[model samples]
Every structure is written in C-alpha cells, then in structure tokens.
Target: MSLPTLHDLHRPLGSTGLTVSPLGLGTVKLGRDQGVKYPNGFTIPDDQQALQLLAQARELGINLIDTAPAYGRSEERLGPLLRGQRHEWVIVSKVGEEFDNGQSRFDFSAAHTRLSVERSLKRLETDCIELVLVHSDGNDLHILEHEDVYATLERLKQEGKIRGFGFSGKTAAGGVKALEQGDCAMVTYNLNEQGERPVLDYAADHGKAILVKKALASGHVCLSPGVDPVRASFELLFAHPGVSSAIVGTINPVHLAHNVATVAQVLKQR
Candidate 1:
C-alpha cells in the first residue's frame, strides 16, 4: 500500500502531542491464537513479522501500537522489533493483568504493579515506556485509587521510567477514576460495548487520549452475514468526534488494507 494519508490516518490524542492514525493497531495476540476465524483474519506476529508490521504501520501512517502485560508474549516480541525504532511511533502498554496458567488474571497490589512495570519495560526493551495504563476490571473500582500504586508510578515518572500513564478497562467509572487519581493521559475501551461513553467523553473533554479497544467487536461485525452493517458500524464509530483512535486488529494483510480503506471512506464522508 502507498503511504496512508493523515486524512485517513491521523488524530491528535489529547495533549500528549502523540498524533496517530485514528485507526491504531493492537497486538493482543501477537504471539498466540485469539480463537477467531477471519474471512481474511488477523495474524499473530512472529519476531521478524512484528518488525515488518510495525514498519508497515509507519509507512501506512499508523503511529500507535497498543499492548498489555497480560498479552502474553506480545511485549517481549515487540521489544526487539521496536528497539531503536521506538521514536517512529507511540507505544501503549497495560500492567494490571498477569498471565497465569495460560489465562489472564488481575492483580492491583503495589508490589505486583512494580514487578509488572519492570517486566514490561524489560520486555518492551525500553528504559521508559511511552504510556503505561492500569488494566481495569469492573469490580473494586477502588483499585484505581490505590495511593501506593499511583505514588509508585509517579515516582517512576519522576525518575524517567515512564513518560505518561492511563488505564484500560470495561467501564467509564473505573477509567474516570484512573484519569483523576493518576497522571493518566489515555484511556481505552470497546466502542461496540457503548458502556464507557462517559469515560471517553470525559477523556476527550479533558484533553486525555481515548483509544477504542474492540472497534471490530472481535470480528463479530466484520465477519457477520451483513456486510453493509459491518461497514456502517465501522464508519459510525470512526466518524465520532470524541474517539481519538481505534485499534482494529487483523492478520490478513488484505483485511488490514480494507480497514485502512474504510477509514479513508469515513474521512471522505466526514
């Protein structure tokens, strides 16, 4: 594909000065199978392919790559691939979840947070991560208010271990709390769920980046029998003025091409 135009690829993610394609890419399964079949599906990036996809993203004008500590080997895979080329884009990682027995589980203890951040930095091969978010779950909304955790994170920021902070979760309340209690610069959620409107709106109004997680709903729409509806949904979300970016992950090169093209169409219509 030719270089993607900012018209189709660009958005200012709040006050971070981290401009990126409104349609960002998330590497949730860069090293594992995500259990969904694509008409032209997504692919988990091998070590070599991770670099290639990132390079391709840059060429295509994408500058945000979302990953999390619970994403298994994704950060480790991205570390080497993105090493010296980190400046080419903004990297987002989460630290509230851990992979245990091949499943994802949450841990919000201050000690766990420190370990998670340290491991994430090592795997991402960065002394300082561009953005680190607390991966939130619905229960225990108080988790975001952990003074010990936020204070530790603030100290890390002061020490230059992280540039910014944020949270990724399923609700507006949790995200809002995170934004208020910490140095949060970004918040992520699934637009299809429509459960975090207030959180995203707050982030948008307050100049914090809002990144949509399941813009594709795990391919529920993309592979649905109704092609027009799928396309319509994509346009509907992309056209939202509040959404700074959407991480629509895919493996098939052609499908990824289709996503970028759809964003172009959405931009044209706007």
Candidate 2:
C-alpha cells in the first residue's frame, strides 16, 4: 500500500480552537539513547537516518512532533529540521527532565521549568512552541504542590512563550489534580495504560484537550485490537471521546507513510 493520509488525525483540539492531527510523531529515540539496547537484541538507527525519516513524516502530513530533552538529542537534532519548517507544524516538548554531560534526569522546580523551556526553545529553534508539557513521568500531582512549576508555565502562557501548556504522566489522579488546579490545557496518555476515563471526562466537560500518548499500548496492542493492527491502532484513540491524537515515532519513511495511511482511514470513518 502507498500508506494513508493524515485526514482522520486532523481535528480541533477540544476548545483549543486549533485543529491538530489525531496522530502525531514522537521524537524520543532520535538521540543518544539510541546507543542503549536490550538483551532482546537490536541496534538503534543513526541520527542522519532519523532526520530523513522526519522529512518523510512532513510529506505524510504529520503536523505535530512531540519530544523532550530527556529523550537525549531529539530536541537538538530537531532544531535544524524544524528551523526550515517552523510554520509547517506544531512542536511540543516537556519540562521535567533534562540531559547534562551525557546523562538524563528530572528537575521539576520552578527554576528548572523555566530553564527547560528556554533550552527547548533554543533547541527547537522557535520563538514559541505550540505546547509545552510538564513531563511528570508518573508524578503529575507533585508538581502542583511545588507551585513554582505551574506558575512559571502560566507566566510563559501570558508572555506568549508558549501557546498552551499540558501535563504528561502515566496516571490519571495526577492529571485530575492538575486539570482542576493548574489550568492545564491538555493531558497526555490514554485508556490503554492509564484508562483515564475520569480525567478525560473532566477535560471534555471543561473544554480542555486530552491527548492519547500510549493509546496504542506502545505497539503492544498493535495486533489484537483491529483488522490491520497498525492501522487499527491509529484509529482506536479516536474512538474515545477524550483522545485528541497520539504521538507515534519511527525513523523510517515506510512507517511514517503507514502512520499517515492509518490516520486517513480513521478520518474517513469519522
């Protein structure tokens, strides 16, 4: 097959008033982490190769690219590619984790949040990003208690440093707290891992946007859920009233084309 288009993944992000594709590209492994491996065996692809894959994503009509400093060089490697195509897409990144001297870890204080955004802005080579998510891992609520992190992001919003803000955790309770208190505009992850029905309901009721991060179960559920597992995985998130889109990654043009095709079929059904 020639692969699908981005029709279904493209939709308004709740009351975001901005139309976003239901499926997006996540840029986690396009960096140094590629050097690491598992006993299961396999080698990570090269950066140049990853960049070419990103180029293909653009051709496929993928409008959103999600990444984080914790993801190693994903943001830095993205700088060159994104600089030329600034207006062609929505770029989102996280603030909780950063890399230093070839190491990656978390820092969610107010100062760290500001520093993270600044670094991301530079790495992304953009004046302002479409969205800046607080990458909480599974610790979303702890950020709320600190106050500085949320306040800083709020200030960034007012200053137009970011178009909007969101939270990325692997759980629901933390998202619920952030959604209720921090004016968090979006929450990531979906029913597969989090089964965040309550939080999604809140976001829908409140007009907040909810994004499905691991909606396809990290490709673990790629097969059992639909006719063609990959294609069906792309559509499953849209079936939920809460999910706005998902961030799928690949350093392969063929996979990018497949993503586009799957999303296109979803749009047709909708």
User: lDDT per model, in order?
Assistant: 0.69, 0.71
Which 10-residue span in candidate 1 carries the lowest summed lDDT? 183-192
- TM-score, per-candidate, Cα-based: 0.85, 0.86
Candidate 1: residue 199 lDDT (0-100): 74
User: What digit string (tens of lDDT, one per residue) describes model 2 on residues 188-236?
Assistant: 4433454566778787778777776655555555345446766666555
Positional deviation of residue 159's Cα in model 2 after best superposition, in angstroms: 1.2
Off by over 4 Å in 2: 1-3, 7-9, 34-48, 99-104, 181-194, 222-227
- Evaluate model 1: give its lDDT: 0.69
Model 1 clashing residue pairs (backbone):
9-21, 42-250, 42-251, 43-251
Tens-place lDDT digits, model 1, residues 1-270: 563444445877666666778777788768556433444455566666666777666666778888887776788888878867887767888877777556768777778878988998899887888778777665536666553566667677778888877767666787777666554434334335676778767776677777777677667654356456446766767655667788876655666667776777777668
Q: Give the TM-score of candidate 2.
A: 0.86
